[model samples]
Target: MSGFWGVARAIIGREFLRFVHQRERFLAALVRPMVWLVIFAAGFRAALGLSIIPPYQNYITYETYIVPGLCAMVLLFNGMQSSLSLVYDREMGSMRLLLTSSFPRWWLLFCRLLGSTAISILQVYTFLALAALFGIVLPLPGYVAVLPGLFLGGLMLGALGLVLSSFVKQLENFAGVMNFVIFPMFFLSSALYPLWKMAESSPLLRDICAFNPFTHVVELIRFLLYLQINWGALIWVLGSTVVLCTIAVWGYDPARGLMKRKS
Candidate 1:
């Protein structure tokens, strides 16, 4: 038990240290969400009207309505960013070192997920603090409640990156993958607007948004921030996490997909 715990700790600790050295990563995480909250929200505030929604007993500004979405955005980007780093680690040979460790490969990867998720959660908190400074604070207790939702969302998204990393062969190809993956995941969901708003434009689009697990993740945070439980969203995020992690483990299996490209 002690040895297993030590292996997990070492893997997680290395990930934390990598983030510490990369100050630029922290800045980029902050910038992406800030652009949405401060710039995009500012422009759209006049165009978007709010009716009373769940968790909001009174009508609130569009800025407040999307705060949770933007908070989720931070996680979305950070999770993917961690994945990007994983790709780099693999190319640079650090991942090879990690994989060859005495611990089971699956356990090591799981530790990596936990570590990246921990950093992502910290980034979410920092973003929230800045949002509060800009006059968009949630209730204090809501902050505490939202942490678990963030963890689950982070794990799901990070696992996605792991799966992608296992399949993608070259470093240069990542830009194309990001374009195909990240933007669609962010825009097609409830991240920027409500489902009703999307329904007005096209029912098909609304349906797609509803099915996307990213939608549930954003909604989960939205409800949690308001001290409400969104059970449906909770289930969707958890289910996706399981699926993605399973695929990742399979892809990274030594006798199979992981070494094929190199061979």
Candidate 2:
């Protein structure tokens, strides 16, 4: 048992070390959300107007309203960024070495997910801290409570990334996929605005956002931060996680997926 844990620790440690070596990656992670929260939300404040929303009572600034969404945004981007690195690693041969390790592939992939999710959690905390500095803090317990939600959400998104990595041929082609998948997933979802807002804009858009797994993820975090349990979100996220991870395993199968490409 100790040996098993030790191996897991080693894998996680290597991932953390690699992350620290690429400090610029952390900076890039912070930049996008900051732009949305600080500049974009700031500009949209007047245009967006105010309505009392769930998990919020009375009036609130547009920046405060979108804080949870932006937190999810950081994780969303980081999850995909980690996947892009995986494709790069596979091309560069590092992934082949990792895959050939004595541990089961699922275990190795789980360890990779753990490492990426840890980094995502750290970025979320940093974002919340910066938000606090700007007067958008949640309760201390709320921060603690939201950890599990973040973990689940991070895992779900990271697993999706893993599934994508198995299919992506090269790092260069990731840009087009991200443009089509990530942006639409994030925007169409209830991440920035509530589903009702989308309904007002267009019921079709609202329905799409309602079905988006990312929307449930953001809703889960938002509710958890307010000390509420969003059961629907929890169930949807758990279901999606199971589905994506299964697909990822199949996609990484030796006789198919990326294995055939290398052979």
Q: By lDDT, who's the top model here?
A: 2
Q: List runs of model 2 lying over 4 Å from the truth.
A: none
Question: Which digits, one per residue and each the tens of the lDDT, describe model 1 over residues 1-263?
Answer: 89989987887898889889999989998887888889999999999887787877987888888888887787777777777888888888888898899889889889999988898899999989999999997889999998889889889888888888888887789879978888999899998889998999999999999999999999999999878989999999999999999999999998887766744
Candidate 2, overall lDDT?
0.88
Off by over 4 Å in 1: none
lDDT of 2 by residue, 1-263 (tens): 77667778988898799999999999988877888888898788888766888887768788877888888888889889889989889989999898998878888888898889999999999989888887887768989999999999999999999998999888889889878779999999887788887898899999989899999999999889989989999999999999999999888888778878755
User: Which ten residues in a row are the worst by lDDT in model 2?
Assistant: 254-263
CA shift of 148, model 1, Å: 0.6
* True lDDT of residue 79, candidate 2: 89
- Candidate 2 backbone clash number: 0
* Whole-model Cα lDDT of every candidate shown, in order: 0.87, 0.88
Question: Which residue pairs in candidate 2 collide?
Answer: none
